[model samples]
Target: MEMCNEDKSNDDTQELSLRDKFSKLFNELEHCEKEEQKQKIEETNRLMEEMDKEEFKSFIGYWKEMKCVWSLHFGETSLSKSLKKTIIDEEKRREGKNEKLLVELCECYLFLINTISAELMPICIPCLIKVALKKEESEEAQNEVETALMVMSSAGYWEFMEQELYLNEIKEIIQYHQEYHNLKRLAYQSAWQFLINRLFNDNNLEGMIVNELCFVREAARELDELLCCVDWKREIEREEVIALMRWFQTLALYFEFCHLWNEGYAELISIIVKAFRASRDDHREISKQCIHLLRKAAEIEVIKINDLLKGGAVDLIFEEILQSTSNGEILCDCLNFYLMISRKLKRMEDFKTYEPKRKLIKKEIFEKMEKEGYEDIIISLHETFNYLSKEYFIHLPINISDYFVNV
Candidate 1:
């Protein structure tokens, strides 16, 4: 028996030497057909079984090389429908076994996901996730699912984020369920539950550590990404977006109360601007909220118009409000923001010189008022503004006059 073990160990050592000799030649691997390469790898792996322990472990290095090679191949030729079809078929082949393979495929895909630019991901991830979700006991599958969720959330695909995707058992078996980048998904889910509790479920907070599922970076990034995608001309679901806007503000308020200033500050200001630009249906309320935030930012100098204009932000805002659903409060806010933006730009080297900002303000207010059949209110508002302007200055001259006279 001792001699037999010695013989086996010797055989393993010899095989290890051979695989190690060939492993460095990975780049030239593409010349061979994929199936031929895979077959060769299998033969090598089989031979490795005779190798010593250290040699046998070199499969990991081989696996890594294969992944790099396959990834590049996947790039040069996008996943064929046949391959995707096979992946899907393999996924459905069993009650469960495909999960292991699915997970492995996902890990491979994730490496590429991190390496490639974003546009490619939308094409690949859905395919990857569809397979991963079929497996029940797959940690790798769960990981892939999480990464997919991360990309989805960060990309501001809210409808996708709202879906409860994991298999029931996966969620149950997960001892530590809240992974990184999945927190915003968790938060959105929890908030939905909070709504449901008011409807049919328990209104209890005991079971849900809602904050545990709170992914700060994901939410922050999603908001930032969405703001960048804010196109004033495109038709979008304004209500859903407004809800998202409110969710961000609520998150900011929560963070503020907890003294999480760093987490809340940037996105809070960003969401306010985005909310204004995104405002459509509940625009009266939304615009009012925007004005409230703009005023606050002005006081703090958190988001100045100069900074906004530098980012081409003012144009988007103008286009957004020009198309807003008219209401009393929104109208009032539009007028006030017009005044505020005018004042801010008045000194800016870029826009301070543009008469259109002031002209647009005057033109827009009357256009909106006229469109809304609020001519009487417009006239009244103008008269009220003039009266207040006079009254405001009534005390202005008297301020330094007495002191000058005394001097």
Candidate 2:
């Protein structure tokens, strides 16, 4: 029988010092045959996990000196190992051996990140960023990008990434990859999910978030093109629609908070209107975001009401309300869309100077609602809204019927 390198101490820590134990494990791991190295590494990880913080830090020092972990995979020091070499090397390309090993390296890297201190993450980020943005073609390349994104998504490293100027890498990755590529699209979409979630949760990162709003607009435009397509049902999946909805929600919140919709406001409003009309009843989440955006536009009155009418905003809301009567969330959103505009026009002192535009907007909206035969539906919607408000304790300063009545 071939005996493994089992410790003879039999669980007796007094027999060997922690340093001696780590040394023994690392030495055995280093000398073990390739087939046995994985088992030895697992044992080492378990031992390291049992160590206290100080002991783990000391082990890091010894492991760095030995270069045991990365050396086994890449035969290069951790400091010098470039993920790109594992990705695009011509020799490795021919042998096909580097691919699996590259995957193992990624797994190992993640494990270390999970088990180690945040102080150690910075050293791994440069290589991660390189492969994340590398536009290579292969499963191995995809694995590299995915793993890099996984590391980037780790909250432990966000501060390091922010300090190191790697914060924009996710945006760059989103811009660099084509949305039509199924596999790569999933990776970047996931990265976007992580990024957007982080941005939404962190209140102190407002300044950093402002710079990303432009990129958000760009992403919204891409989504608009897809959603407006005739074959969008085939091209866009539910997951992609969910991502689009969240992005729109984020953009709408930004507009409401900052009133930064001056740049390309008309075009964006048009896109929002079109997306609402296109998605209709099939994607209520997306429709809810569209209504939210339109309400923000109404609250700010950044674009003239005539421009919104021309963009088909009034008709879009009516159609959405007609189709979404069963979906109370969408119905409430549509009602709020109109009430928001009414509230702004009725309450704002500044609108006194712009009464003609507000009156014209209100007149045109009523005309459209009457001509389209949606007045009764609007009345029914108001009744339902009142019922819901009482049942759910939903309170608004202004009532839906009072929207069209004189202040």
Best-performing candidate as measured by lDDT: 2
Q: What's the C-alpha lDDT at position 41 in model 1? A: 54
- Across 314-372, the per-residue lDDT of candidate 2 in tens digits comes to 67776776774546655665666667656666664365777777676677777877776
Give candidate 2's error at residue 209 in angstroms.
7.3
lDDT of 1 at 198: 23
Clashes of each: 3, 0
Candidate 2 stretches with Cα past 4 Å from truth are: 1-130, 137-139, 150-165, 168-213, 228-258, 281-310, 322-325, 351-356, 370-379, 390-401
Candidate 1: which stretches are off by over 4 Å?
Answer: 1-179, 184-220, 224-246, 251-292, 311-313, 316-325, 338-381, 384-407
lDDT of each: 0.41, 0.55
Candidate 1 shows a clash count of 3
Query: Which ten residues in a row are the worst by lDDT in model 2?
Result: 61-70
lDDT of 1 by residue, 1-407 (tens): 00010112335545435544444333334446667656655765566666676665433322332222233453432333234444556556656556556544544443332243343334444443454234344565544454433322222111122223322322332213334332333334333322222211222321222343333433455556555665545644443444454454544333322321233444445555666656644344555566554543433333444444443334433444455344444444444444555444444435655556645544543454455544343343554454444543311121221111111
